[model samples]
Target: MNQQLPLLFPNAISLTIKREDLIHPFVSGNKFRKLKYNLLQAETQQYKTLLTFGGAFSNHIAAVAYAGKEKGFKTIGIIRGDELGSKISENPTLSFAENCGMQLEFISREEYRLKSELSFIENLKAKFGDFYLIPEGGTNALAIKGCQEILTPEDAEFDYICCSIGTGGTISGIINSALPHQKVLGFPALKGDFLKEEIRSFVNKENWELLTDYHFGGYGKVNEVLIGFINSFYQKNKIPLDPIYTGKMVFGVIDLIQKNFFPAQSKILLIHTGGIQGIQGMNMKLRNKKLPIIEIND
Candidate 1:
């Protein structure tokens, strides 16, 4: 509901950032939008428990945990990779999820891979019984409905709407709700040729474009330039951006803007998907880089 910062370029064109990151301290950003419909569906079905998946620091897990607690439903988090409880007392996000009464189930990468199959989900359902399952990142038809609610009629018209593609749920939903005249662009954070097809299959939208070049590093990996940009962006605008999602998307948006990809007089909207808590561990890795030297001709 607060006024978000807008960046202006040449002519009267401008870029507006939807401050979804500020949606809540825990239930923040697109996570909230993505979870909105899932929660309603769970209630409608009279399901008392909600089960979902994510990594140790996953914002999706955190959001679901919080939502479950607030709405009086039991929550479970199926974590990717191995357990990290031996390493530290608590990673902040996981700790928050635990505090919200989410039962954590850490699984191997191979097991997590089978998560999408009905047989695998049925195995869990047999063990837990009668629980509603929300997919990782809450990307589904219901989630799309929730994300569509984030857009307001008063918002400026734009030819293209850009968002970071994670599981492709948010952008798919945005594409589903957007006018035919608008183009939805997704900048993938992973390195793979299959994501475009995956998104197409998920959202089934034909007016979407995927830009794959901006992921300078893979997911959760940040370089010096990204860190510098994150710091400078905060210094200039007092906005906090996580290195994983929004930071990468913003970096991509800036790159595209600099390339004159969008007309100078066109309006652009960048969805700020929230993942701030994940950045807590990025400082050391992002700061430990040696700069390359450039030769000067005298």
Candidate 2:
């Protein structure tokens, strides 16, 4: 669904949001897109188990857990923090994944970074037997393929296409399918330009750029300002945005608009790639800090 913003902008600019968040309840937005073909491929190969990696409050972990359960595959999540293993009851995301029957294995942060190494993978295969592996953030060739379908012929009229960048699969797909006249802008959740090369590896198009200014101190790090913005935005727009990705993207887009970063009369389409499951976890963190929680609809 394309929803127009209520606030009028200068230069006759119009802002619209592609509510990809509404695509599914548990496996919503980019998570749904990323997993679509991977699930089919797993079933095609008759794989009985799926193994993936994530952090404590990761949306990927939650989505993969539910996807595996619904698709009839045994799921295993290699979580980053070993300490989180003992605190599953205190963490909403981990608890949800656990509830979905995802076998959770906790590892040190250093070990987590070596997840892509051949030696580390051999260790996993030795322990878990044969299983289909989905990379962290679920980005792969098939994922990009599913994300390509996010834009349609009707979306060609937009001058700017904006979305939050994760593993770069979603934006790469959008860039590949975007109209020649449209520019795809990515707001990375991580605070780095290293994603440029990662995105370039998956796309041949030169129509996209990563906006690095709005990460709000990198992935999973949010202050009161961002929390306040997310709460207010949801209150006004009735759209629940997760703090890790969509919330930062929306905040950045609005801030850029106020700064006149876009030309007057430019039509903007923002992709609301869902990660709403993280809201409860984020709110928990906020409450621990005695800060205001995100205002989400019941």
Q: Each prediction's TM-score against the native? A: 0.89, 0.98
lDDT of 2 at 297: 80
Clashing pairs in 2: none
Identify the candidate with maximal TM-score: 2
**Candidate 2 local lDDT, residue 26:** 92
Segments in model 2 whose C-alpha atoms lie over 4 Å from true places: none
Q: lDDT tens digits, residues 1-298, model 1?
A: 4344556566566777878888887888888998888898899999999999998678898899999999999998888877665532447678888888998888889999999999999999988887999998888878878887766665538777888878877887788777877888888877766777666775655988888887777777667687778777776667777878888888888877787888767777888888776765454333345432111111
